[model samples]
Target chain A: MSRQTPLNAAHRKLGARMVDFAGWDMPVQYTSVIAEHEAVRTAAGLFDVSHMGEIEFHGPGALAAVNGLLTNDLSRCADGQALYAGLLNDEGGFVDDVVAYRFSAERILVCVNASNREKDFAWMTARARGCTPVDRSDEFAQLALQGPKAAAILQRLTPVQLSGVGTYRFTEGAVAGVDCIIARTGYTGEDGFELYCAPVRAEALWNALLAAGAANGLKPAGLGARDSLRTEMKYALYGNDIDDAHTPLEAGLGWIVKLDKQDFVGKAALERQKAAGVPRRLVGFELTGAGIARHGYPVLKDGQRVGEVTSGTLGPSVKKAIGIGYVPAAHSAEGSTFDVEIRGRPVAARVVKTPFWKRG
Target chain B: MGNYPGSLKYTKDHEWARAEGSRYVIGITDHAQAELGEVVFVDLPEVGKQVTAGKPFGAAESTKAASDLFAPVTGKVVKANEALKADPSALNSDPYGAGWLVELEPTDGDTSHLMDADSYVKLLG
Candidate 1:
């Protein structure tokens, strides 16, 4: 069954086109993908990200319990700060990606994708060991206020002194007469904030922010806009770009893996793989022929099957067809030559640099 | 509602064809362009190529999705819009005007295999 976000009613009222995304009925677009994508790029865009999972871990054992749960060192995360980390299994394969925020030394909240919520909660609960893990996904909603003008728009509705919130930093503040957690982070490669608050108040806060950002061209953006924005940056989606079968090293996310850190799930295998270096690596490419490369299209290096296109699109930002795929490490360098087998034809494509486009 | 120029013949696949004398200019419809949303890259059909009715001549991809541009009529491609090589968004800007994909010489003058603008618009629903 498809789930609905708390802001579903609000999205409907705005005439958003909705679709089933990973079992959740989410808005894919409001006005249009290009318009919404530009709204976030040029100005500010509000997103109903309430479908994302938010879980709270409290009590004394929270710190130790979460440390073992995630690959990143939670000890490095101070109070009122956030860290992007991955949850891995014993094989060093990623189970899910999340933003871990420390409310205090004894409390932490991890926000994950909606599809991974139940599985993540079950995994955490089975090994609760000493802490109390609460599934707050059903109790809270998340909204991403993204773009260059997002900070100014959100500052008007909240008294949180937004200037002080650095990147990846979060604060407990009040907006729309309700307490909220504002995190200075977003999927879009822009300056923005992700606000977490009570589920019941989602519609009210969404509407209030829309009213405040009206003058700034803030449209209530949706998943369609979000996908394009992130794709422009070559940001990987969970299932499309990375999954449990693939290790972080192969997914081009080796930067997130800290081999020297304390042992976590999948640590040993990752350490060995890191020492030997990855055999296959993920890289981005641009289509050169008369076809739009899509997911599952076989990737070829000199007429040989080397990999397949994982995620691809004609990016709205750069106005070019860009996609990511795994290839042999030797062919992973920028400007390498490769052929994308689109529709059973070897379309000439070059291994361009990842993030086919970047913000100026 | 999207723009449906009264002068152009449209295909159910969202491609619009306008016959200019013996040559025909073809491209995606404004409704199709708006549906695709912010076309960035347009895969233009090669000139002098043989195309069949309902066969995908090429594609125009936007952030939202990539849509195949099917040939409205069976013809031999005479020309392709080269401007879209650097600026494919001309399709989104003017799908019927400067955004014309391929100019073809139709195999037949009788409208045998394509739908009209009104019929195509009704097919969208």
Candidate 2:
């Protein structure tokens, strides 16, 4: 049986199409993926992301302990800020990509992919020094209110000034009478807030947000819209675009890796890989031919299989078939031509700059 | 939870076929389109292409995934819905009418192997 999130019942009440995602019974869409995708781009969309896991590090050395395990330099984040980072194995390959929220010197929170929850907790607990890592996955339910009108909708329910929270910043406040950690962050490349509240209070929060944002065109989005929205932004999805076998540099996430910082888990391997020059790199492309390139579809160069598509979708907002995949470094440049084999036929494609949809 | 026209014969693969004189009009069932979700592209064969029963002839690509379109009866394609190449959401909106994939001139003119609306509904259940 798949695990149910706190708002599972609420999702069913809203007539959502439910699917098993990362072993959790989550809503894939309430109405349709295209409508929900357009809503986030034009107005606002609310999402239940409670299936994502959260791990808390406590004690005076919390920051240092967590930073040691991450490829990004967490020491740079001030309190009330969050940074995206990669938890890598010693071989410089991703264990999981995560977002670390800095609450204080002693209290830091790491949000991880739902599929890597148990493994990530165990990995951190065994290696953490001078701090206690607690699995708080079941304790909190996460809701993402994303898009242009997110602040206006949220501000109507909370006394906390939404303007005070800048991008990637967070603050503890009460939303609809429920205590929540409101973080100005999201995966959809929209200005939004990710609210973390008690699981018991999730249903109330969800209902309240929907009611508050109804007139503003905020619809209850699901995992399907979430996937397409993030894909347009070229945000890497764990187990697809990034995995335990691929290093962050090869995944086009080198911006998050701060090699100049102190020694981390994958420091030596990353240093070595950087010196040797990364071989294959991830590239975003749009199908110039007839078919939609899907995940696991072979990426070809000169009629030979060179790589595979990691994430692909018909981008509703962009109105094109966009995809991301790995290819040789020579073919990873912008405007480089290749073919994505769709249904045993090679379809022409061209490498393009990522974030397929840019905000006007 | 889809409307299955009683006049059309159905395949277990979720295709619906309607006999039009010697030729048959073919398209996916409403249930199949709903399951696929938001058809973005339809890859139909050329007008003169040959297709065999139970064999895949084309594809319907959705935002989430792609599903193969199987032939319900063996025939030579007399006409292909070229309009779907520009607007495939018609598959979801009108699976029985505007969304018809192809018109096939059946070689055997037999559909005894296919199911009726009642039987297809039962199969769906």
Highest DockQ scorer: 2
Ten-residue region with minimum lDDT total, candidate 1 chain A: A255-264
**lDDT score, candidate 1:** 0.84
Q: Estimate each model's TM-score.
A: 0.89, 0.98
Give candidate 2 regions above 4 Å deviation. Answer: B108-110
Across residues A21-70, which tens digit of lDDT does each residue of candidate 1 receive? 98989999988888898999999999988888988899988888887777
Model 2 C-alpha lDDT versus the unseen true structure: 0.94
User: How would the docking of model 2 be graded?
Assistant: high
Model 2 chain A is weakest, by summed lDDT over 10 consecutive residues, at: A123-132
lDDT of 2 by residue, A1-360 (tens): 999999999999999999999999999989999999999999999999999999999898999999899989889989999999999999999999999999987899999999999999998988777787999999999999999999999999999999999999999999999999999999999999999999999999999999999999999999999999999999999999999889999999999899999778888999999999999999999999988988899999999999999999899989999999999999999999999998889999999998898987
Residue pairs that clash (backbone atoms under 3 angstroms), model 2: none
Off by over 4 Å in 1: A285-293, A314-320, A344-359, B3-10, B17-25, B106-113
